[model samples]
Target chain A: MLAIFVEMFSYDFILRALIVGVLVSLCSALLGVSLVLKRYSMIGDGLSHVGFSALAFAMVLNIAPLYVAIPVVVVAAFLLLRLSENGKIRGDAAIAMISSGALALGVFAISITKGMNVDMSSYMFGSILAMDNSDVVLSICLSIMVLCLFAIFYNRIFAVTFDENFARATGINAERYNALIAFLSAVTIVLGMRMMGALLISSLIVFPPLSSMQIFKTFRNVVLSSALLSVGCFLLGLCVSYLWATPTGASVVMANILAFLFFYSIGFARDRMKG
Target chain B: MSLISCQDVTFSYEGRNVITGLNFAVDKGDYLCIVGENGSGKSTLIKGILQLKAANKGFLTLGDGLRLNEIGYLPQQTNVQKDFPASVWEVVLSGCLNALGYKPFFGKNEITRANEQMQTLHISNLRNCCYRDLSGGQQQRVLLARALCASHKLLVLDEPVTGLDPVVTMQFYHLLKEINRAQGVSIIMVTHDIKEAVSQADHILHLHNKQLYFGSVSGYMNTALGKFFSGGGQDACNLR
Candidate 1:
């Protein structure tokens, strides 16, 4: 078994997928705690759907997917934020509107592009073998940016996420921090969509923090454990997919679900013991 | 200079005038209770002073070397905010985040400040406890400790004892009084509990029918409206 695991890394595609997967998982978990606590987890799903449409457009135009998707998704994120803040639309409703609209656009674009039929399933459900060297480099660079930005603004993020009004009253620009979260999340969602697919990427953003919350009470602990859990789950899922001939994205999501249940059971048993 | 002063402050919402030509001043170390009937804009006045809502007209200033960030505020509670997932320590420590502009993390000084405030509120043992798991009174203490961590100059609280039981309310009031008397932190509180406000506050600002009455607590009690409110008439008092 150990030799088989070692042999898997010898393949360039597998190595690239593992690197991107682990990086995406770590980035997702770092932002997930705040997003979940702030009731903004669905933004990830919304932005991923938007990314799908943007990727289809990029494919039709024969441009780099990230170049097309990043700006479009970030704009959509800011638009959603503005609408919610101005009371023009609610958060969930705005997400639903953009998400479904983008999903429809993506399908329409795909139907029109004859050559795009080859990798449609891979785009929708993700394929570990699809990552090239360029994808690995871009993912590495963007993931590092997300991590550094998150670390640099950790305390400010905590303050804004915990109580935005109070944070604003204390001279922190809550809206700016909120915008930063949205923008970074848009980038993360777009990048993860390449590996996890548009449909499954948000689970990467939600499950780790939720699982961590079951075991940890403090924000710092939740963030730290979430990072650990996310990376661990991604690696475990990758291993399972390679050994069992399953889909990588689906496998990772399953690992996350199981981890959530496991942590929840531990929390429940601890509560019982205390009672 | 007074810690907080609002001159001819007029605040409106959706074209409806909430307060027109309201004026009041809170000097350093003064416990000023703002009393008003429902729809009289007591809470709006707090918001206007805190700059959460900008005043439509007139000037509001913080003095005695106090800036907006130096004023600790305990906003009115809502159902959603109470469900936030954080520890008592995190919540309190977040109060000093304003002081760490552009810094990557909280310093040891901020942590020590949070600890001291928790000790002051006697919630040191509950530091690791989840905020959502705390009882109503304990939660209020945690919030008060958070507010304390924000500022030593002035604390602006909007109905800090709203959901507490009578015993807890009295205990909370005594705690505020101690913080005010011992530490010399100025307090500007909004409350409908005329009795408690009268008993605890040194000064009072009564808002009624677009009129502002700023006076000592005893002076306010001597007025006919104050007599009506303190006599348990309850018409002008809103517990909500």
Candidate 2:
């Protein structure tokens, strides 16, 4: 087992995947707590679909996918925020409309251009070998920035998520912080889509916080546990993928599912014991 | 000078006038209760005062050094908060976010304020407990502590005791009364319970899509609008 683990790390592509995966997991977990609490968890799913279309367009244009996809997804995220805030289109409805539209656009772009090629399939389903050195460097820088921003604005984010109206009443710019959250999610979705695939990226933003919530009761504890759980699950998923030759994204999601169930059972038992 | 003065303020929601011809003033250390039936625009008026919504016409002014952000607010609980994973300490500390300005983390001063507010609400023991795990009354206290941490001058509460049992509701009311009397914080509360409103508040602003009556509780009791709305007659007077 030790030898196999060593052999997996020896592969350069695997090493790159590990580094990026861990960072993306941490970012998603941190943001997921706020998103889930805000009832905006579907925003991640919506943004990933937008990212898919943006990546398709970038490929057709022969440009850097991150450059095109990041801005496009960020814009889509802001648009979704505005649409939901306006109340004309409810949040879930707006997300559904935009995600399905973007998904259709992505499929159309692929059909018109690559016509279901290996590269397109990799983007849709994810491939561990898809990330190059440049992608790795970009992901690291952006992920570090996301992490720092979250840490710095931690209190404000907490205020916004817990009680936006109260936060706004107290003079905190709730809208701005909300926009900041949307912006960060956009960047993280784009960054993770390369490895996790557009279809699976939102699971990273959803599952860990939910799992942590089963066992932890406080916001800080839940956040800390979610981060730890996300990273741990990602590593375990990577090992599973390496050993069993399973898809990395599916393996990671499976790991998250298992963790959620484990935590849920413990919480249920603890409640029963207390009763 | 009054802490807040409204001169012919009218608020509309989506081009429909919810509140019209609103004229009132809140003095420092005043306890004013806004009582009305549903869709009577009590909430719209509250939103107008909180600056969450703008008046379609006229002016609303804040005086006595009351900035817009300094009005502590205890809004009705949303569905999201019912299951939110937050500690009493975290929720209370977050009330200081406005004062935090560009600071990334809470300073000692903010922490002390949160602790003091928690103590004041008698929930210091529950500081580490999950907000979602608490009783409805305890959760209201936690939120009240958070609102207190935000501003010392004024508090705006919207139907604060909506779902609690009678005992907890009375306790919450008494707590608010104490905060108003002892801390000298001005309070503008919107309540469906007119009996409690008349009993606890010095002033009443009765609304029915417009300002039906706005004056001292004694003066309000004399008015026909107040008499009619408070279930009429001798029982209304007995409430006070």
Candidate 3:
């Protein structure tokens, strides 16, 4: 097993995929705690659908997919947030409308252009070879940016997530903080689309914090544990997929699901014991 | 000038007016209780004062070196809010976010201030407790302690004691009175319980069917509406 693990890193593609996967996991977990607590976890799923549609368009236009997908998804995220807040449409309704519409559009675009010479299913379910040297560098920089911004705004995000009305009353601009959260989630979702696939990317933004919440009682503890658990799960899933030739995205999500159930069982047993 | 002053304030929601032509001033160290029937815009008026809602027509000012974000607020809790996953310490420390600006983390003084607030509210031992697991009265005290960590000058609360038992309500009222009188922190609370409102408040702001009244408790007691209430007319506001 140790020899197999050592030989796995002999390939450059594996190394690149592992680096990008770990960084994306960390970014997603940092943003996930706030998003999950705020009941906006589904926004990740919604935005990833939008990213899929944007990627399809970029393929048709023969443009760099990341360049087009990042801004397009980010704008869609802001629009969704704005529409939800304006009371003209509810949050779940807005997400459902946008996500399904984008998914349909992506399907249509793919059928018309035959994915414009790109392997469409690979983009849909993710491909390990997607992380080239340039992709890895971009991923590193963006993940660092996300981590730094989250750290800088940690206290304010805590306030906003707890009670937005009270936070606003106390003179914090809750709307701005909310937009910041949406923006960060958008970037992470877009960056993660290549490895996790658009269909499976949201689990990265959801499962970690939820699993952490089962055992950790405080926000800080939950956040720290979530980050660590996310990276650990991703690494394990990547290695398992490499060994078994399984679908990487599904493998990672399965790992997270198992972790969630395990932690939930622990929490339930603890509660029962206390009783 | 008073610590907080609102003149000719009119608040509306979805283009429907909830409060109109309201004028009230909260002086330094004043304990003002706002009482009104349901749908009488009591919450709207408090939100307007907190600048959470913009008045359709009027000006609101915060004096005594208070800014919009510096005023502590303890909002009425909803079921979802009550289940938030945060520790008592995190909740209290969050009160200092307004002063953090672009800084990422809380400074030592901010943590100390949160500890002091927990101590003041008698919840220092519960700092590590999860907020959602606390009892209603304990949660309210934790929220009050969180609010106290903000400005320590003024607190705006909306229906803060709605779910507590009578004993907890009395104890909470005593805590508020102590904070108001001893600490010299001005308070503006909205309550449906007219009995506690009339008994504990130094000043009263009464709203009924678009009519507004603001004055000292003694002055309010002499008015026709106050006399009606003081004369055992418990159903006066609730009936409307």
Candidate 4:
């Protein structure tokens, strides 16, 4: 295994994969803070599936999948917001619609293009072992955009996400901030799908923030710790996958979940002992 | 001058009319206590005033001279919010977010204001504590302090002392009185504690069957419903 990793880790191919994973994880971690705060944990999952479905169609139509998928997922997120506001579906019922519908659509598109260079294994789990230059660049760009958004709108986002009514009475237009969250969620989901794949992507978004909230008492702590955990998970999982030729998305997601559970359980124990 | 006035404000949800055709008003520094049976629209009326839910049929004007930002609100504590993972400082700091105009970090002035509000609410020491880890009464104090941090003019609370002890309830009332007298902030509170509502409230709104008995606290307490409705037997401090 050491020999395997030493050889692969030196190769530019593995380096690119590592870069993509780390960058995407960082962005997802930031957005995960908002998603967890807003109680829209499921939206990240829903949008990722929508991206997957759009990816298949883009492939069949011979277009760049990110272009098609990003717009469609963003629109789907907006629709989810509108539908929920109108009471079209109550309490995450819309999430079920988007997740299941998008999953089925993805499978159907894949079946139609099944013979058109179908690398089912790679798409299902993630093709980190085979990532190209553009994927690495795309991930870097998304991460930078996410950081930029955070820098610019941190206060409004904090106010709206934590206590929306307070934001509103203070004249901070919560609806706009809520829309920003949904829009950012769509973009993050699209970029994240390439690294974690549709099947395992949401784990990074959910577990990092959840675990960080365990020991940290402040919103800023939760944000910073989650990003740190995410970067660490991505680097560790990438190394393991490069060494063992494991399923890349599953390996990373499992590693993140394990790390989260470990720390969360420790925090729980410490709290109990104190009590 | 009347800072807030309502006329025939009706509100409903899912076919049940909660607060029906209510009419009332609050002058600056008036502590209005609103009471009614469960599901009789006491909370609904409060929510209506805060614009949490708009009136379906009538109007509530927060006075034309005042901007929307002047009205402050403190919602009731819910069981679900008790587990929120935020600190007392963070919670109090959230109040200034609207005033600070969306900057990432808090500057010296915002920090000063937040600290002042917490100190005024007598919870400045709890600033470093986790909001969810505090007792029920402590949580209420934290939220009240948070409200005070942003409470520029109007202070609206929905059951401000829901689960607090009797002594704490009195302290809560005293704090409101201090805020009202010092800042000249008008307050309207929704409560189930009838005797306290009658005794402390400057004005009383006894809501029943889509009608509002709008008058001075003593006037309403002298009525038959107020005499009976002030928790007739359970209450020890009966009016002469």
Candidate 5:
């Protein structure tokens, strides 16, 4: 069994799948810290729905869905920012409005476009099984940019995520930093849509961070642990999905959740024992 | 030179004038206290100073060489911040970002400053504590330590005494007074506790009817309006 597993890891498709999974997982883990800390954990889920709408619209217009979805999700990301800043609508409400409306619009578009054939199951779950080289390249590029940006402004972004006014007072340029984060979040949502899909993407973004919070003592630890956990989950889930012939996105999401639960329970037990 | 000054600053929310023609100033090292009824725009005025709200019309100036980043502010109890999952150390270290002369990540110097402030605030025991696990007073003290870390020159606080018992409130006030006197850092604190502000402040800023009465503590005691407010009179005190 060990030899079979080792052999499978060397196969071209499997290697590509693992790489894509790890890259996307790291992206989600990096962004998840800010999102969860900002109490905007739902941002990924909402933006992914917008990605779905853009994908459907692109399908109707015969344009590349990734190209169309990028602008759409990024714009929706900005809209959420604008509304929340307008000081009338809070983050969660803004996310709800965008997510529900985008999902509805996506469904409506898919219903109307007769010639635009889509595998609904693939959209509902993810179609990581069907990724081409271009999709893999996009994931790697997006993940690298996202990770690097976080690295460059890790302190300022962490401060802003936790407290905007404080970040501003510290000369962190809260507005620009926040917008930059929102932009990256949108980009991640759109690019990751290919692998995680709309319905199941939110879990991938959240569980890794939640799980990482368990044993991590420092902020950097929490973030790094989350990234590592995400990568591990994606690899395991990819292999399991392939072996079982199950839906790829759902399998990966479930894998992440299971990993989260496992770590969460261990942490919980440790704390209880200390008591 | 005045450390901070606001001239004829009026602010409105949703087109309703919350404050009009409000004016006040603080000299270097002056401990200023603000007292007002609810909606008298105490928070609004502070928010204006923080640039959280734009005044309808006003000029705000910091003294020569006083960078905006040099100012440290603690806001009133916020539902948004209270639930955040951060540690006491994280909360306090945030203060040094203003003065660390570096980016967000802290080095040895910044950590040392954070640790020193925590000890000074008598919250060294809380260094590893979860912010939510602490009592309200403990949390406020940690936050106060954060403000202390920002720079020892100025601290602007809005109703910082909230969620504290009177004993802790006294301790908090004494700590502020010590910091102000010892470090020569000016303090501008907003509070509705008129009696306490009367005794504690070197100067008092009173807000009523969209106007201000900025003067000495004794001057505030002599005002008929002060008497009226302490009497709990219902003369637009809450509305203003």
Candidate 6:
């Protein structure tokens, strides 16, 4: 097992994937706590679908995918935020409409262009070799920015998520902080989608916090544990994928599912003991 | 000058007036209760006072060095907070975010203030406890402490005791009364419990799509609208 680990790390592409994967996992987990608590977890799913369309359009236009995808998904995220705030359209309904529409556009683009080639499939299902040296550098810088922003505004984010009306009453710009969360999530989604695929990237933003919430009762503890759990799961999933030759995205999602179940049972047992 | 004064304020939603012709003033150290039936614009009026909503045709003045952000607010519980994983300390300390301006972390002064507020609310023992694990009454106290941490001059409570049991509700009211009397903090509370509101508050503002009465509790008891809403003349005074 130790020799196998050494061999895997020796591969340059695997190392790059691991580095970016760990960073993306950490960022998503940190933002996930706020998103899940605010009932905005679906924003991740919606944004990833938009990311798919952006990637597809980029592929058709023969441009760099990240360059096109980042701005497009960010704009879609802001539009979704505005739509939800408008109150004319319910939040879930807006997400459903936009995500499905974007998915359709992506499918349409792909069918009309290269007819679902290997590169497009990699975008859909993710490939370990998809991340280049420049991609790794970009992911590192963006991930650090996300981390620092989350840390600096941690208190305000907590206040806004816990109670927006009360936060607003105290003169905290709840909408601005909410936009910040959406913005960070958009960037994280685009960055992670390269490795986790658009279909599975949101799991990074959802599973860790939920698993930690099953046992941890306090917000600080939940956030800390969620970050640790996300990184652990990503590494574990990477190892499994390397050893078994499975898809990286599905392996990571499966690892998360297992962790969630494990924590849930522990919580259940604790409750029974108390009773 | 009054701490807050609303002059003929009219608030509209989607171009339809939800509250109209609202005129009232909250003086320093005053305890005012706002009561109204469902759709009677009590919430709209509160929003207007809090500066969450702008009035279409009236002016709202905040005098006596009271900024909109300095008003301690204990809003009604939302579903999002019911299961939130937060420590009591985190929730209470968050009230100081407005004063924290540009500082990333809470200062020692803010920390000491949060501890003091927690002590005042008698929740010092529950500082590290998870918020969701507490009883409804305890949760309200945590939120009240949070609100108190924001401002020393005034408190704005929107149906603060909606879900607690009767015993807890009375205890909560007793705590608020103590705070109001001891600290000289002005309070503007919106509640559905008219009898309790009449007894606890020094002044009453009743609304029925408009301001029906705004005066001392005694004066409100004399008005026909207050008498009817307070469940009758003699019982209202007796409760007080």
Best by DockQ: 6
Q: Comparing to the true complex, what docking class would candidate 6 get?
A: high
lDDT tens digits by residue: candidate 1, B23-98: 7789989999998878788878877777889988888887889987888988877654665668998899989887
In Å, candidate 6's interface RMSD is 0.7
Can you tell me the CAPRI class of model 5?
A: acceptable
Model 5: per-residue lDDT, tens digit, A1-275? 88878877777767777777777788888888778767677878888888888887777787867878888888888888777677677877888988889888877887887534555556656686646788778778887898888887786776777677766665557888878988988887777666677888878778888887775655667788888888888877887877897777888888887887888898899889989
**In candidate 3, which residue pairs get closer than 3 Å at backbone N, Cα or C atoms, i.e. clash?**
A170-B69, A171-B69
DockQ computed for model 4 against the true two-chain complex using alpha carbons: 0.52
Instruction: For candidate 2, write residues A1-275 as lDDT tens digits.
Output: 78998999999999999999999999999999999888889999999999999999999889998999999999999999888788787889999999999989988998898787888877877889878999999999999999999999988898889888888788778899999999999999999998889999999999999999988999899999999999999999999999999989889999999999999999999999999
Best by lDDT: 6
Global Cα lDDT for candidate 3: 0.88
Off by over 4 Å in 6: B232-240
Candidate 1 residue lDDT tens string, A1-275:
88998899998889999889988999999999889888888888888999999988888888888889989999998987777677767878988998999989988888887545757777778888767788789989999999999999998898888878778778888999999999889888888887788899999999999998888888899999999999999999999999999989999999999999999999999989999
C-alpha TM-score for every candidate: 0.95, 0.96, 0.96, 0.91, 0.91, 0.97
- Candidate 4 chain A weakest ten by summed lDDT: A115-124
Off by over 4 Å in 2: B231-240
Model 3: native contacts recovered, as a fraction? 0.87
State the TM-score, rounded to 2 decimals, of chain A in model 2: 0.98
Least accurate stretch of 10 residues (summed lDDT) in model 4 chain B? B231-240
Off by over 4 Å in 1: B233-240
- Tens-digit lDDT track of model 3 for A1-275: 89998999999998998998999999999999999988888899999999999988888788888999999999999998887777678889999999999989988987897644446777788888877788888889998999999998888888888898878887888999999999999999998998899999999999999999999989899999999999999998999899999988889999999999999999999999999
DockQ of each: 0.69, 0.84, 0.79, 0.52, 0.38, 0.87
Candidate 4, residues A1-275, lDDT tens digits: the string is 77876787788877887777777788788889878767778888888888888888887787877778888998998988776667746748888887899888878877876663535545656776545677667767877887798768876777677777666766777888788878877887787676578878888888888889888877778889999999898888877776677877888887888888888898899899999
What is residue A120's positional error in candidate 5, in angstroms? 3.2
C-alpha lDDT (0 to 100) for residue A212 of candidate 4: 91
Q: Whole-model Cα lDDT per candidate?
A: 0.88, 0.92, 0.88, 0.78, 0.78, 0.92
Which regions of candidate 3 are displaced past 4 Å?
A115-118, B230-240
Which residue runs does candidate 5 get wrong by more than 4 Å? A87-94, A114-118, A214-218, A270-275, B100-104, B228-240
For B8-122, candidate 6 gives per-residue lDDT tens digits of 9888888888888888999999999999888999898888777888889888889999987999999988999888999999999999988998899999999999999999989
Candidate 6 chain A worst ten-residue window by lDDT: A116-125
The residue-level lDDT of candidate 2 at A98 comes to 94
Q: Output the chain A TM-score of model 3.
A: 0.97
